[model samples]
Target: MSKFTSILARTFLQCRPMTNVSTKNMNMLSLMKSNSNPINRLAILSISDFNKRHKSSATSSLADKELATFLQDEIENETKSMETKATSPTFEGFNTELKDAKVILTKKSGKESFKVIFNVNNSLDNNSEEEYSEQKNVSDNKSNEDVELGSPISKPTYTIELEKNGQIMAFYCSFAEEGSYEDGNQSSPDSAGYSDLYRIDEISIYQNEYTDDSYSVTCDLLDEQMYEKLFNMLEDRGLGNEFASKLAEFSTAYEHKLYVNLLSKIKNFISS
Candidate 1:
């Protein structure tokens, strides 16, 4: 018999006289004394199962505590790292407006006003070293200087609209990360003498607005000289190489801020 059964037997014998016990109660006691009896086996099995469950629950609780601590530390580190890495809120003389995933900037030049619109959703991508170096040139101002090469940065297809006397000329533009200015057109007389960054992909001239039926003229259809003139038209209005670099830095910083907020949400969920 096990030590527990032996102790049980001794306790029962010492607790009462054998002559006073009923026969049925004595039979039950006899069955309990045997390890092979179903009743006794069930009792032992139940105690073992209870101990295992208790141990598992304790281990799970400990793991949860450790995970919570790790998340908290990570949150703190990311928050501190981004404290000074905010994107510049102001972009020269333009009035800035943010709506969800889109950023709108508007500026007036003499009798003409222009709007630059870009979307942040699905715009971020890993940047090459050459492009990253170019982006750093305009980081001297109020925003996003901490982003390094090979990091995820904003590469958006944006739109610029120049309006004068109720007529609007819109340029659908993209950035050329590599080998765009090798044609010796970098010093084009119409250019703002800024670095070659922005590219005019398409141009559309509309009156009173853009409708579903409006036509867009692709830059590929235009000659090199015409394209250069169109590009310079935008550069003169402040959407030049410098603005391109600053906008990229701003977008990177903005995306990082969003990422940190997401991390914070995850941590809160786990802790809760």
Candidate 2:
């Protein structure tokens, strides 16, 4: 079998095939969705509202809209980074100068995982073909599985934010205790265990060009202690568990439009 196919078979790159629900199952889902609990009811309502908005405007689904917004933001950030390098005396080439990047944290069911965004330094790239090759090692730790994921992650613009970030040292996806974390592209997390520290260099603040929000945090020189600090920060704000749970559900569930709403809501909720 081809190396690429081998990785797909074992790695987290393969999304679980979504199965169609039978008519009886659909009825059960309807019944469960009608719970009087505020939280459960809101979820159903949000999903309905999300689909309705798309139909009303004859536009993309909420999930698509969110994905588009994320990619657009990534592009804008990457372009700004490139512009700085082009004007700099030490500027190298486009391939070396990373415009934008992202890393998704993976965990099993009921675990907390999230995604982080960062840019790159073109000067730092080793420029090896293997660095960006289709046969490159995937971030999975269960085994030495190979999958394709370099700059821009996937060919589709919408998949840009899904790219895992790296430079000299590189980044690996975090794993949960013992479960599948499809959202983070991490498989067999339980078997391999999780990494505490996610070392990154040359990180910087995300320039809020689209909005007037003050978010100046350069994770430059982030160390092991600092990684723990992030979780502590979330915990201090009392959003650590909630954040992880929402992310897990969003990653595995088939109807993602509702998760988009949840993500936006969480973004606003925590940012406030």
Candidate 3:
């Protein structure tokens, strides 16, 4: 008989009724396997079925573990990217009012830079008349300065904070100076009509695991149009030969450092 038929015959014999009837036993005996006794064949078939079921379950468990690990790694990478993006400075869509303008020259790089702060006092003045009048003189002076310069100085100042591998290393401000027109001749200290100039201050670079060294870098003012053009070029394709050329035009070490830091952050984000 075929192996399938043999296994089936053995199962029927082993499961037959316990009652002893000579004629029934004779009839059942006719279904026995050709080579093996009924009991032995039945035992082999039961063991084989059990092994097949066990193997199928083990394979399923292994596949589940592999899938779980893959999902976990994907989640971790996504979380890191989100956190980095949250902390990093974005050039676009920034809005803040600039105030308290000052100029400084860095000795290390021999570059002149401007720094400014946000006009938070104005918001408070808007709510309180007394506060508004008290601060009016300061505001008037700033307005006069703007008017004398013949350009609206309403742009917001932004502070750039730098970090390496999730630790803040330095902070600096981008500022603008009002140009002066002396005796009908435009005689601004920075001959460039650009109101926006960035200055680097308060730098802290890590010297070791437990200590940090601080230094200040100077700023070199760039023409507003040239600055914008360079910014656009970098935005299109960041920090390559073309961008480097534009950066070279900036004579100040502080300016170079700011541009490099910004470029590095942008490149890392894009590649990620």
Give the residue spans of candidate 1 off by over 4 A.
1-74, 84-86, 128-150, 179-195, 269-272
Global lDDT of each candidate: 0.75, 0.37, 0.38
Q: State the lDDT of candidate 1 residue by residue for 1-272, as single tens digits.
A: 99999999999879876897899998867767777768777988799999999999899878877887887888787677577566554688889887757889898989999899988777775455356666556554537556443346677878989899999999888777544354433323344644566677788989979998889988777887777787677677778778887887877677667767777777677667
RMSD of 2: 30.5
Cα RMSD, each candidate: 13.5, 30.5, 23.2
The deviation in Å at residue 254 for candidate 1 is 1.5
Which candidate leads in TM-score?
Answer: 1
Off by over 4 Å in 3: 1-119, 122-158, 167-171, 180-213, 218-272
Candidate 3: worst-modelled 10 consecutive residues by lDDT: 101-110
lDDT of 3 by residue, 10-67 (tens): 9999899867768767555654544258687687668989999999978876776665
User: With candidate 2 superimposed using the best TM-score fit, by how many Å does residue 24's alpha carbon deviate from the native?
Assistant: 62
Candidate 1 vs candidate 3: the TM-score winner is 1
Best by lDDT: 1
* Cα-based lDDT at residue 182, candidate 2: 36
Candidate 3 lDDT at 226 equals 50
